[model samples]
Target: MEHSHKAILVVSFGTSYEDARKATIERIENDIIAAFPEYRIYRAWTSRMILSILKKRDQIIIPNVCEAMEQMIDDGITEVIVQPTHILDGIENHIMKDEVLSYKSCFQSISFGAPLLSGQKDAETIVHAIGKRFEYLDKNTALVLMGHGTAHQANAVYEELGQLFKDMGYPHIFLGTVESSPSVQELIQEISNYGISSRNCDSADNDLPVEKVVLAPFMIVAGDHAHNDMAGEHPESWTSRFQNAGYEAESVLKGLGAYQKIRELFVEHVQNAINNINE
Candidate 1:
């Protein structure tokens, strides 16, 4: 096989769910491969727990970012681009960037791609991309997105994302997180305050005013948090609460990475990073 002097390392938090990995992470990787046929591509995961789980349960072996970089340097690949699948400039992304930078001297050059939602325009772009995923919802149904929020100050990305949806005339679209601001209860209250709740019923045809609520993950990959926290049968899950509240709740069970537009944004970010390297 022909070798390239440079390579692209696709970094993700990784998932134990093979199907989700295919639908989201792999799809993004494939897009990157298609765009840069001359450059070899590699995969690295950030979540040691997920990597360990996959190794034990599925016998899947994937390297972490540092390991992948060491392998690349050993293979004579001198330059690298590290593209992450994180949804925001949150804790995970910051750590990933730091790790990649620590290996900068090991390579001739290294550039890191921005997270999925980076700047203000990216927030708007993602709102439109994710919004397109739920065009089927009617006025009587609320669309609630569950993001995997971070303890980092960058958790404000979710807040900004939610605000963009509302500012763009999608007030019925609510955003919540499993580990940060705008919890499910907070989003439910937002829905209720918007008069899209059973308590504000208007007619039997519409039933509970807000007859249904579509729940989807706002994260890059719909792995553990998406399944167990957002859609699981557990009483604490988002689906359970909405169901108990007399609303028809449905889970999309897909991540933002599953969307074409979202992937395009990542590709654009990679291109920007590559351009920066060229400059």
Candidate 2:
């Protein structure tokens, strides 16, 4: 490997599921490595619970932000750039940023990248990226994205992103949270309104009421939230609720990190942070 004074530390909330852990989080890290080959890349998990579970069950050991930073500093890395895989500027991301900043003096320059939804056009960009994937859906289908909500004010990011999708002329797309406002009931109401509106419209023959719904996780990893809260066969899961309400519902068990364009956005954020440090 080529010796470099700068290093890139990718931080994530992490997942316990090995398949999801590989498909989403590891894929994002790999993309970052390809983008900045000159910089030594490292990964750190913010979720101590997940990390502990992985260690105990699978014999997998992953470092936290503090430990990763310590290794970088010990290796004489004078410049370090921290890129987070969080989807929003919520409490988790905020804590990650603070942790990265705590090791500032250990390096000559330390820069932290913004989360996925930080920039003005991020929402629109993400909407387009995900929208393109489900282009085959007809007017009778609704897309419901389940996000991990937060009490932090940044929770509004999900609502704003959903609005951006609507503003982009995709009204059938709905956003719901696992822990905040715009709950499942709210999503049902919104989708029901759209269904009613479609039925009332006397437009062309192609126009039809939404009788089918697709549920997906608007999260970085399709772990517990996606597997249980969003798609589990439980009566309260989003898929189950949608089915119980009369719409044929199915869940896509994948994360945003599975998308190429989405991973490119994280790479862009890392570049932006590095550019800021250079400036």
Candidate 3:
């Protein structure tokens, strides 16, 4: 319960997967601390389901925005900056904003930072980062980046980014979502239009356009969705759909947070909020 005049509350949806939590979320937090050592860093998770699961199963507790803010007030912290690790300004970000704003008067200054795909520039930077990360792939292989889609209007960001991936000098790199448009099925159709086949059949008719795909999670953490919905053996999973559609599938089981560039972008987001608070 120590007090620091300035603090950065790093907020996320949170995951119970120990390895993913460590690789993505914890690494982002560590990068934030390294970038802004002067300011104390705290953590908050918006998902009540995840929080409850962690508390009951793992015996770990992470505060939500309201609780964290109150804790800051109790500890005599004045200025506050909240930086969400979400991919877009969707339902989760909206919740964080509303809750964080409730305690505006409790701090000298309060600022909220942009999420990963905040603006055009962020998207552009992300494009190159992903391109470089998967540069090892050849023309015959497709990269299907799985994103956690939202019900909110912000869900459009995924489709927008989907278009951005097309012919942006990153060949056959596509995006799919679990919730909305540009779903894996939709991407299947799109990929079909590109003739990126996965058929390595054993029949006499072997003259097929063969291709392999690398599936990766586009979200900050490769959690349940990455393991279940995206790569799970279930017939409805993206991996199965791709396989059923006659394409070979390989899942990367990695999240955006594992990349240093993505982590650095998050740190930049925190720094941006800090600068805005000072101004």
lDDT pick, better of 1 and 3: 3
lDDT of each: 0.87, 0.89, 0.87
Cα distance off (Å), candidate 3, residue 171? 2.1
1-279: candidate 3 lDDT, tens digit per residue: 554589999999999899999999999999999888788888999999999999999999899888999889988889888999999998889888999999998888899889999998889889889989998987668899999888899988888887887657775789888888788888888777666333544555333343678899999999999999999999999999999998899999999999888888888898898888777
- Candidate whose TM-score is highest: 2
lDDT string, candidate 2, 23-112, tens digits: 999999999999898999989999999999989999999999989988998888999989999988788988888888898877899888
Per lDDT, the best of the predicted structures is 2
As for TM-score, the candidate ahead, 1 or 2, is 2
Give the range where candidate 1 is weakest over 10 consecutive residues by summed lDDT: 201-210
In candidate 3, which residue ranges exceed 4 Å CA deviation? 1-3, 196-210
Task: List, residue by residue over 1-279, the lDDT tens digit for candidate 1.
Answer: 777998999999999888899999999999999998988999999999999998999888999988998899889999898899888777788888888888888888998899888898888888788777787778788898998888989888788778889899776788988888988888777776666454566666543356689999888888888889888999999999988877799998898888999999999999999999999
Local error of candidate 2 at 84, Å? Answer: 0.2
Structural similarity to truth (TM-score) of each candidate: 0.93, 0.97, 0.93
